[model samples]
Every structure is written in structure tokens, then in C-alpha cells.
Target: MLKPVELDLSELGELAQVIPGPEPKLELSLSPIPQFGAERPRIIPVCEPSLTGNELKYVTDCIESNWISSAGHYIQAFERAFAAACQVRYGISCCSGTIALHLALAVLGLQPGDEVIIPTFTMIATAYAVTYTGARPVLVDSERETWNMDLDQVEARITPRTRAIIPVHTYGHPVDMDRLNALAERHGLWVIEDAAEAHGALYKGRPTGSLGDAAAFSFYANKIITTGEGGMLVTDNEELARLAWTLRDHAFSSERHFWHKFIGYSYRMTNLQAAVGLAQVEQMANFVAARRANAAYYTELLKDIPGLVTPPQAEWATSVYWMYGILVQDEFGLTRDELRRRLAQRGIETRTFFIPMHLQPIYYEMFKGERYPVAEDFCRRGLYLPSASSLTRQEIERVVDTLRDVRR
Candidate 1:
């Protein structure tokens, strides 16, 4: 069993007095040995892609073929491969994850006044996508255990205006898909999963994208796998895929040029991006494995710390651990902000978790007086550790050591 160590914040404050404040660091460093070279400050980003030789080769092939625009063989190849990976019938590539969500809403024919249930603890894009479709986003609190949408609260929030539910797999942890899907089925509501943060995540032996009617993914620079900037929508419905494709590319009819069938925005993915995506997709399994390994290492290092709670994996959910998180307990004697500041002074980069969207200014204006106490409290205390894939074992050790020192 792990023994918890109580943190002494009073000691930390006194130590901070002696600790030197932030200073401007040199941009580069030089060494006398020419061949040995010099070292630069390594930036441990939150997430990074692990590229393979095939990625470069595919880009070279795209250059050689001159299929560098939005339409190319690489696009179709990536879509097919990604769809296969997700165990879905079809996949449509788009310009961004947000655009993919927008496409999902549009393809589903969501209209003004329709209500979409979203988690308050997710990236703003989830709710923004619903708003883009001229629908209202009814935000729900997260489950304390998994940090995903609270299923009971979601069920309670459903109304006559509710048209869909977008359960975000936050930080690559799969939500309670079985329960969410069951709720959707019972209510006859559309299930469009906002899986932007969970590419290879699984629930009950099935991939996240395959668990819903439709799902969206992101390939932004910081994601586990990146295509520079791209996204994808996966679905088993052929007609929905066709609609998404048309809507992605200006809603043009395939039969004729410039034949506008419906009003749509140009959210197409370039062949170059798709080429990069195909390369990244080929390496996703390894990337996910590495991330999981890193999370395990973190858990082993910090599980004994008192006043700190590491992310918990659900019984039926297998998380990719895109970002390792730690919740500072009230008894810790240190606020999340204070911990973040102290870590920064030690040359470690850390970030707080998402601020619940329900408390945002825009949402406040819309809802006027609504409040989610649990979501609000979690946001005030949760902090994300440095879990970047580029982070080396030594760096992780340094972070853990610093954390241990602070607690002591």
C-alpha cells in the first residue's frame, strides 16, 4: 500500500523567500569541443508526435505527384486507414477538429433552438460547435471519478429541446460510452462524440470513435498524433459520411462543377496535411503505448503523495493519458495556483485543467444564473503535470523530485 505524505505549505512559503525569482535565460549555449556541440534548454511540451520514415516518404511522394491541394490520393488513403483503425465504415478529413464537430452537427441537421448536452469540463470547442449550428449547449458537470461527463446529471438535463449529446473523452480517457449510448438510445437522441482528445482510447474493448453514431478527432501540433493541423470525422452511417464530405467542401454536388446544393463553408483538408496524417496514423499505436508507459511511470512516482490525487482510470475505460493530471486536495495546504507557480520556478512547465465552461462570461450571459458547484470546484483545484511525449525520463525524475521536495 502507498503511504501518503502531508505537504508543509508554510515551509514552501519560507523556501520561496530564499528561492531566486525568474530570470531571462540565454537563447543558445556553446561548448569548447566542436564535435560534442552545445546544449539548449529543452522545452517539454504537453504533447508531441513521434514520426516515422514513412511520413517523410509520403510527403515526398505527394510532392512528386503534384497532388498538393485539398484533393489527392493521400486524403482518401488516410481516410480509409483511419476509418479502419476506428473500426468505422467511413471517415472524412477536415481542416480542424472544431470544423469536424461543426460538420457533424451540420450533417445531422441540427437547427436553431435545438439543445446539445456537453460537459462543462471540456475544451471550449465542444460547446462552440453546438453554438455554431445555432443550437444551445446545455453544459453538464463532470463525474468526480473519471473526470468525464456526469451521466446522471446528463440524464437529468434532457428536455424536449434536447437533440443530441456530445460526451467528450477528455484527456484521452474514454467516457462512460455504454451508459451514454444507452441514454441516447432511450431518449432517441443523436450521439456525436467529441473525441478530439481521444484518438486511440478504448471502452469495453471497442475504439472510442466506433462507440457513437459519429465522432471527431484532432491532429493539432500538441495532440498525440499530429498532421500539422487537421481533423477527422468517423461514422458507420454511409449517408452521414457523404453529407459530411459534401459539407466539408462547400457543399458542392459531385455531378457538376460549382453546383451549390446547400450552403456550406470551405473546411477541406489539404493533400499535404492528409499525407502527414497518414504518416502519423501509421505510428499512433506506438505513440499511445509510449504515453501509457509515461503515465504508469508518473503514477509509480507520485501515488504515495498525500493531498494529491492522480488521474483514475475507469474499470471499462482504457485511457491514452494524453495529459497526466493531479488534483491537489484541500488538506494539501497549497492551492493549485501556488503549486503551479512553485513548479515554474524550478524550471518545470505546468498548466491548470480547463475552467468549467458554465462559469465563462459568454455562458454566464446566456444562462444568466446557472451554476455547477462540482465543476466549479474541480476547476479551481485540478492541475496538469508535464506529460509531454518529448519529456525524457531524467526530466520526469526531476519533476517528481521537485514534487517530493515540496511535499516534504
Candidate 2:
């Protein structure tokens, strides 16, 4: 469930006293579509962090306490808090989302040559993490509408060696976790949700991270919430949680310090990062609301533009609009690359969708002769506009106008 931010103005008399009152506004030429002989306004960045909360305060506390390493009150507090936020029993904070996936895979005990199914449209980290565990990643195409993995390929990709499926929640819109989990259960396979993009997003009233057997989340600066650079693995199974905890560190036995058993990597988030993460987690509800509002405004302004398919919101999903992507049809005149260039020339930053993994040169021999047409098409046409949570109503209008004016 998305908890919308509710301000109580009556109780903030002290805050209200310090806030400057509204003043007369000046009219400047700021339309995305410039008037004849007028100059367009300056650039708009694609994303920015909204860190107006206790980030500094909590981090300062860690420094003052002299416990700024991975071990501190803040670390455990953040794990518990984030676990609760995801509606899971445990959240093992790690170094990055990639490492989180690595830990989850390691905990699953996937040996060399074991295949893990993943969507080719996701960030390379998803596939790389599987490779880190000595497991082979089987690529699947994305759905045309949602740009998520086409579930129909799951069965085709799975075999006796197929051990797990990693369904990444792309653009803050969750994959059908319930259905994915049902499929996993049928094959006795594990489901590791790559929920790096779906923080605060819900599917059928359940949080994305909680729906999968174990989920990995990224706290990269551009994510819905940030901890500078951190990641977490949340799970309902205590054994999985325990194993991930050890795997994140040096795989030392918890029974004795400096006692090593299995191979492990150093993937620990410091107390300082956790301090920042805790603060961000507290503001999650409000941050998601702001992103959703910004996306809604963009939709409202762009709906009338021909040949532009807006970010999808499925009947069973509540998207947080993490990147606010849109598909540019050929009828729009400019190709996606050309549009991106034009948008950049107009001082509006944009990002194209990830190149399909199947098309990447690194996998040429492994996936040769295989074709995933839908993923190819979406990768060419899909691009994300400026989706900063701090985007203003006027900014959204300007972006839409600039897009509307694109031509051959």
C-alpha cells in the first residue's frame, strides 16, 4: 500500500513561523515550446535526490558515537526498519544491489552450469550477479506493454539444470510476483526478486519484495530512496536470512569471530550508510507520493501527444513511476535516438532503455541464433524523461511541450 504524505499544518506553528510567505511572482518566458524569436529555458536534469530529512543528523550521530563502521546500532535498526517496510522478516544490508543478488544466489547454492532465468531487458547487474555465483543466466524477452520479462518464456527457458528465476521489477512496476511464485513452486525453483526499482510499489496489495522468496533492493542514488550506495536482501525464511548475513561478510561462522568456513565476499554497508538509509526509509512514503505525483503530471501533459505510449500501469499493479519511461512510435517522426538528441539539445536530459542482453556482444556466442523481437523493439523505442521527484508542475508541462514539438 502506498502511504501518501499527509501534512498537519496546525501542529507546525513553529515551522510555519519561519517559512517565508508567498510573494509576487514574475512572468518569465519558460515554455518548453518557445514563442517565435524567444529562447527556450535552461536544462532539466533527469533525476535528483530529495534529501531534506534526517540524513545529516543520523550520519552525524554515527560519527559522534565513533561507530561508523558496519557494526553499529544504526545498522541493525536500519535492517529491522527496512525489513518491516518491505513486510519481510529479515533485511540483510549489503554493499550494492548487485552484491545483494550475489548473496541471494550464493545462499541458494547454485553451482557452476546451473541456469538462472532473467529478463534480457534489465540492467546488466542482474545477469552479472548470476554469473558471480558460477551460474548461467538464461535470457528472456520483455513484454511489449510493461517492458517486463514475458512469463511465457519461463517454461521454455527452464530445464533440469534450471534452479531459479530472477524477475526484476523494472521501472518501479512489479512483475506478477504471485504468478511468478506459483510458477516457481511448480518447478521447485527459487524466486529471487530483483526489486531494485520497485520500492514502495505494490502488486495485488502486497509489497514486491515480500512476495518473492527472497528479494534484492538497490539503494543507488537514483532509486526511489537512497543511502548514497547500498543494497539489501529481504526474506521470510530465517535460514536464508542467516546464510545471506554470513555470505555478505566473510562467510565466517557466527559462532566464532575470525573463524572462516565457506568462501564469501566483503559486502557490508557501513554504519554511516545505514544511518542515511534509515532516514530515507522514514521518508519513503512521502518520497513515493512525490514521484507518483510527478509521473501523473507528466502523463496528464503528454496524454494527447500522438504516437507516444506512456508508462504502463497494470490493473494489478500500483507503479511508483521510478523512471517515467515512454515508447516513441515511428509516427512521432523522430526515432528514439533522434528524439533523445533533440531533447538533449533542448536542455532536457533523457535515458534510453538498456540494450537487450541477448544483443550485447559479450553474449554473442552463448545466445547465438536466438531472437527476442519484443525486447529488441522496446529497447530501440523506449526512453525515460526527467523523472526527478522534485519536478514542478510547470517543469512537467515544459517537458511535455518539448516532446510534442518534435518532428522529422
Candidate 3:
């Protein structure tokens, strides 16, 4: 069981005095108000999709044309548009981002017992996708600077059985793609980018998805863009694109009806989802701009706080700041959990960074408490602020003010 930590905020009185007016009350009483048309305090979600008015028109067109299923024009349009945006030759839409990763693994010709190196600090789906392809997931620790796979550790883990590398762009920060790509080229290994959180992010002016041999993107509701639930796989190779297309729909062939050309899974995306995705894609540039601006605002507001270490942007990378995360300094004498609870008490939402995969129950039983100190440290110290695209400047100010008060 996880032990709870207590937070003492008495020291914050000095900091609270800096902000104008009385500090907000840390508690509120519930009122029995009517369900409809009642004013409530604004909620700053972690993310909110930017949907322009075109979504309903496209969705209605899909429904009216009786193309709401997997085989439809909207799906093809979305695939093409996304491929063009990523600067890749082809794109395959899948039911979800996890399936996109699985398809990339399948098309890479991974076999049983082969290994794929992945960051231990990423989401569980990264490892699961490799498992689905009958390949073992070899976890590597993250670097303290960027919260991404440490290239040194990755190189150390590569062996005869290592078949590929999946470098994830954690938050909106791009991984060290040049180093990872060079390593893959040297080892003759495939590079599959897990770009789930970096749709519009760039590295040296090139898009994240275009940096690898193949890349997977998520359009889940919490992402910078949403399609309810959807994903896309992009590749520049024609053969790989054809393979992904065939494998995503159960390997059906044109010449042979009901005959399977290869073993595959049903991972097709519906037209309804694609319609929503297409609309979101059209506004991706604007959404990315807003996210970058908001990140700048937060940095300007909180840079002076001695206990907070804001997210870093590498020289070669331009992050969209999908979520504004900070590492609480040890000098602050407070744990991330303590800070999270204090912020929550002030009606501010925050989230902790992902725990290293090695610490998960299943992985822990498999690896037996092997240490990856940096990843573990990040899990304990990193906290994410509210970064919804819908957040107004006033709301962001309130959040910053609350954080400033807690730091005192």
C-alpha cells in the first residue's frame, strides 16, 4: 500500500501576501442547485480538444452518406491529410494509439523472443505494444535533463536479440532523435517513434513523426487534439505503408475473397472518428500556437519560484508544452504528493509524472526492484499544472497565484 504524506502550509503566509487581495478559501460547501443553467467555478482540465464548427458538418456528411463504418472516404481523407502534415509518404489510421504501435511492430517483422528497447518512464502501452508483437520489451531509464530515454542506457542494452527502438516524446518534448536514429542506423535496427504526446511538436524545425522510420500518434480526448479515440501510423516507405494498410484490416487481399494473406488484427478506425480527427487536424496549427504561448505565460509567471524547475526546451527542439510540468526542488522540503494535495485543497488540479515502468506491480515482480534512480526520482518529484487549451488568461493567473501562495 502507498503511504500518504502530510503537507504543512504555515510557512506560505509570506508568499501569500504578495498576491493582490485575500487568498482564496481552501474549502467550499456544496449547494443543492438546479442541474441546468447553474453557474459554477471554471474547471481547468489537463487538456481540452479545440473543435472548430466543422466537426458537426463533416460528421453529419459521413452519416448522411452511409459511410460511418471503417470503409469510408473520411478515413482516407484523414489518413492523407495527416500523412502530408507529418511529411510522410503514407499514413494508416487505427482504432487507438496502442493499436498504431502494435501495427508498427507487426510491419517491422518482429518475431517471438526479439526485443524492443523502450523508456521505462513512459506509459504502459508502449511496452504492451511490443508484447502484442511477440517481442520482449527491454526497458531503459530516462535522462534527468529531458525526461526521455537515456541514449547511453539504450546503447548499453542493445544486443543480438534487440530488433528495434521505440523512443517516446514524453510530454511535448522531443526525444534526442538524431542520436537515436544514428544508433539505429549503426545497429541496423528499426526506429519507431511513439509520438503520442507530440502531434505538432518540432525538432530542428522538422515534425516529430517525420524523424523516425515510422511513428505513432494518439488523438485521445486528453491530447492536444482529439477524435474521441483514434491514432495514426506514418511511414515514408511504400512497402511498409502497404503492409500496415493490409495488416490493419485483417490482411484482406483484393484477389482472394475471405482469404488472409498474412496473420493480422482488426484495428481499423471508423469514419465517424476520422471525421472528427479531420476537423481537429485543420486547426492543429492554431492549437499548437496557443499551447506554446500559454507555456510562455506560465514560465514568465512562475520562473521566480525557487522550488520549481520548469520544463526545458532543447536547442534542437520546439515543444508545444502539451502539459506544463515542474519538478519541485528538494530544497523546498516538500514532496510532490504534498504539493499536489495542497494545490487540490485550493481547487487547483494537478497530476504526478508517470512512475518508472520497472516499479509497476507486474514489472516489479518480473525484475525484482532493480533500480533506475532517475526515473524513480522524477516520479516522486514531478508535478503537472493545469494546461487545458480552453483556459483563459484570468484562469491561468488564478492558478499561478494559488501556486505562489502554496510556496510560501
Instruction: Give one digit per residue, the lDDT tens place, for model 3 in 1-408.
Output: 976433222332332221122223343223111231255555455567767658999999998999999888989899998888888879899988898999999998898989999998888889889988888889889888888899999989999999999999999899989988999999999999999999899998999889989999998998887889989999898999999999999899878878987997899999999999889889888888888888999999988878788998888889988888998877766666677666667567777788666666545555544567777777767878888777777767877876776667
Model 1, C-alpha of 382: deviation from truth (Å): 1.2
Candidate 3's error at 315, in angstroms?
A: 0.5
Q: Poorest 10 consecutive residues of model 2 by lDDT? A: 18-27
What is the alpha-carbon lDDT for the whole of candidate 1? 0.82
* Cα lDDT for residue 221, candidate 1: 86
lDDT of 1 by residue, 1-408 (tens): 966543332433332222222322311122112322354335444455666638889988999999999878999999999999999989999988998899999998899989999998888899889999999999888888999989999989999999999999989899988888999999999999998988899998899899999999988988887888899999999999999999888888888989998888899898989898998888888888878888899989887777888887999989988889888887777777777666665556676787667555456457545666666666777778887666677767767876776555
> What is the number of backbone collisions in each predicted candidate, taken in the order shown?
0, 0, 2
Residue 262 in model 2: shift from native, Å?
A: 1.0
Q: Which residue pairs collide, candidate 3?
A: 11-408, 12-408
Q: What would the TM-score be for candidate 1 when compared with the true structure?
A: 0.89
Model 1 / residue 342 / CA error / Å? 1.7
Q: Which stretches of candidate 1 lie over 4 Å from their true place?
A: 1-41
Using lDDT as the yardstick, the better of models 1 and 2 is 2
Q: Roughly what TM-score does model 3 have, to 2 decimal places? A: 0.89
